[model samples]
Target: MSLHHTASQEATRRTALRLLAGLGLYGITMPSIGQAFASDAPGWPEAAFKAKTQDEVLAALYKGKLEMSKDVTIETPEIAENGAVVPVSVSTKLPGVTSISILVPENPYALAASYKLADASMAMVGCRLKMAKTTKVIAVVEAGGKLYAASSDVKVTLGGCGG
Candidate 1:
């Protein structure tokens, strides 16, 4: 066989192996991708039940009963220009997460949102949220019959206030 042909074949073999390794790791990590059974209407509770102030929301969502888990992660921009439409995403590496919810305390309603998951599946949910002002955005994951949470701050800037 020609040297050039052999080299090409070798590169293809390496790429195929890399692809297989990635697939194998994915299978091991997210085995329950399509088995998450969540409620049709996993509604959020009243604001009083969630929190009022930003700190209160963080405390309620990420403290004591709501322990932060390494399996869950929340993503949001460090700075948001228009508080009316801030993008946020919640994702979990844990298996069998029944549902996930996002909450913003300073808003008119503290329970910003909730999302049900498929049975035996990992979930990654993204949505836009409104912030009355700079506030904490939290992700709460219901998995293995318990609740886990993660939180991050989103800085909202007015015309001259961010200075």
Candidate 2:
């Protein structure tokens, strides 16, 4: 056999071995990739994401317990030229924050985004959200096993979330 042909065959064999290894077929066990990055992991609030009203979402996520707080801050543009990509950020001075959630009451689903913070992690998060129109953007922070919230108004010229 030609040397080039032999080298090509060797390369193919290595690739096959890699494929098998990736699939955990060669006496190896592989973790479920889906489970590793699933949205349905433990403590995920599925019902809150599906809630249509802000009250429902708050209730589903925080058991209807929330208080207005000045320590929580919401930063967003007063006017959003594009509703499809409205930038929003949340930060809190409250100690022992465990989670932060963003809510848009006018959107199809009031819950825009939610995040869980690790112990001693900074109480801050940022993301883009779609808006249906001019609406209040609320940031809810969970600290010391209690929920506190703050809100700001954002006006959208073009409707996102199907207007």
Candidate 3:
């Protein structure tokens, strides 16, 4: 190979090595990054995720009952053409919302998604969930240490999660 070609290859090798070294250093320096993903991290509702029924999930997560509320709003398609990727969004006007959870009662696991919000954070969450069939999509919010819920029925034409 020509001398110029050899030099170019060496430069490329050095650049790649530097990039790898930088990434390694980043991983070593960021210790909390690992903790953020740990399943046993504080406040993670492990039992709730494993619960089968909505009542069980609520008991596991909140240890209290939820009341239907007009302040909690659920925005989802009335009919989902495909059950595999139904978009769902939840928002609440209730003050001091600490968490939001989406539940699909007919799914193998009742809890589709759950998010913990910071103090004074906007009480809104959006996610896609897989549905086994047509079912009511429930949005539960924890505000001021109380549970509030809203639900909307979504008809799925195509089955998702093996219907």
Candidate 4:
């Protein structure tokens, strides 16, 4: 074959190899992509998220499977001067943690936030919660097919959750 013809054929071969490699990578990653979407599947617990009572929300998520644990720690201000922006942090030393959830019992909705965690992630999460008044701020952690909880009292001086 002529020099130019061989060069053109070599370029085409390179392009074909690249296309196959790309397809192979996509096939390998497709399952994980589907899993990510499933984790975020649309029918998010709408009724549970909207529930006004603490017991109702807990039943929806944990099915009443909860126990107080010393391994879980909840950090919040002893007294929140601004109820609109009260910072909170939760972490657990327990193994096999799958999720972390925060709840403010006195707020209009008891379930403040819920996080789905991967096995590789740290068992710690932080977020700000609004408080209508002084109340217990609870952290629920799911680990090894069981739910564990910790709570702290935060006194909110300013109105939040339409206090």
Each model's number of backbone clashes?
A: 8, 0, 0, 0
Off by more than 4 A, model 2: 1-43, 159-163
Q: After superposition, how far is residue 62 of candidate 4 from its true place, in Å?
A: 1.7
Per residue, candidate 3 scores C-alpha lDDT tens digits across 30-68 of: 445637654343334567788999998887777467899
Once fitted onto the true fold, the runs of candidate 3 whose alpha carbons sit more than 4 angstroms away are 1-43, 159-163
Measured against the true structure, the TM-scores of the candidates, in listed sequence, are 0.59, 0.71, 0.72, 0.70
> How many backbone collisions does model 1 have?
8
CA lDDT of each prediction against the hidden true structure: 0.68, 0.80, 0.79, 0.77
Better by TM-score, candidate 3 or 2: 3
For model 2, what is the C-alpha lDDT against the true structure?
A: 0.80
The whole-model C-alpha lDDT of candidate 1 against the native structure comes to: 0.68
Give me the candidate number with maximum TM-score: 3
Model 1 scores worst on lDDT over the 10 consecutive residues at 39-48
Q: 1-163 in candidate 1: lDDT tens per residue? A: 1111245455754555566778766455443656765322112233324475545543433333566888889999999978878999999888778778788866766768766576745588999988888888878887766678899999988757644
lDDT at position 35, candidate 1:
71
